[model samples]
Target: MKRGLLFPTTLLLLLLLGTIHAQPTPDPLDGGDYAQVYARAQAGGDAVTASRAAAAMTEYRAGGRDWTARAVQAARQATTTRPGDPDAQLALGSALGLQARAGGYTLGALNTAQQARAALDRALSLAPDRPDIQAVLAEWHAGAWAKAGIFSGGNQDRARTLATAAARRAPDTLFVQAHAGIALSLIHDSQARATLTRAATLNADTPLERDLQTQAKRVLEGLKP
Candidate 1:
């Protein structure tokens, strides 16, 4: 009887250990990594990046429910965590702008873009000769100008100017080239093709760089006669 009881107890312990080991680890987002949260959200499906990016871009106007809210929260956290980091501020601004745009409020989108512009401006002020900062700022300005809706004050001339400046400042940067392509495409100029081609030739590894390159290609393709 004692031997039988010992065997059963040992079996139960072995089963419990197996169960514990078999349990799958939770995603990083669930464990409090916001960057991983964004990554997981992006990896969700079909390059969605998040439900908002997938849904809101539809032709029939899909509503952005909590997507904007989450984006805002993430942005705030990033900005707060590193007050002196321009990259953090840029991420915050980008998140806010994306959320606002997807939410479909022109004023809100413009405001968010402006906030991003301000952060970029501050970054430039702090490090005037920083190539990366200049490159990003140029992209932001060009994108802001190009994407301005009819209700917003979008000046094509200004957009072109900014894009040109960005290209000049960071001629080798993929994002700057992409932004220049977008701006030129908006103006229906032949230069867009060259810019887009140049952007594609560069190695874009980061999500942000990939996004810019993809956008540039799309814009360039759309402009083809």
Candidate 2:
């Protein structure tokens, strides 16, 4: 009886182990989970979730054109579904900016940049206290100023003012610090190095924050002594 009980127990343990081993590991992309989130957001009329899904797709799908397109679509849906949601408008602007960056400084890119500016302006109007959005708007102005021409409206002075405001509003946030530092660097501001150094030294809690830290470091290295 004892031998028969031991055999059955060992078989049960073996089966448990086999079942555990057969379970698939979770994928980082989670088999395109962003799509499901976006779908759910749409079905539930949830602007926040839609924006989150759009932003996640932009970050996770990085260099893929299809991913960027989908991100733009989701962001647009979010903004349209909740016209008063500042976060949704911000997401839409950010997605459009990403697409513009991917396209470089072509006419299409300039056009997209203008649209991004419009969306960002709307977000700012809705939530003027958000430092992150201010930083992005500053960066947009700075980038446009750097590549300004007949087709693009870019004002360096406006960029400087916006960057200064963002820095003042959120001195501790890496996003504000890094972007403001970069914008200041473009005009050869004396404080750019210190701001970028602070940004680089800050601990990053997310992939986006890490990217901002990396950018700060690169900009700091490029500054003249």
Q: Which candidate is the best by lDDT?
A: 2
Model 2 ranges with Cα > 4 A deviation: 1-62, 149-151, 206-208
Tens digits of lDDT, candidate 1, 1-225: 999899999999999999999997642322323344455666553122342232223211232535555555554554566567665555555555555455454676677667766766766676666655555555555555556544344455655665666677777888578756766676665667887788877887555556556777777777757
Each model's RMSD to truth, in Å?
A: 12.5, 11.1
Q: Which tens-of-lDDT digit does each residue in 1-225 have in candidate 2? A: 999899999999999999999997542323456767767876787755665565556655453666677668877877877889887888888888778877886889988989989998999999998887887788777777777643567667877888888888888888799988888787677877887888998888666567568778998999999
Pairs in steric clash, model 2 = none
What lDDT does model 1 reach?
0.58
TM-score of 1: 0.57
For each predicted model, how many residue pairs clash, with residues at least 3 apart or on different chains? 1, 0
Give stretches of model 1 more than 4 Å off: 1-68, 139-158, 187-190, 204-212
How many clashes (backbone atoms < 3 Å, residues ≥3 apart in a chain or on different chains) does model 2 have?
A: 0
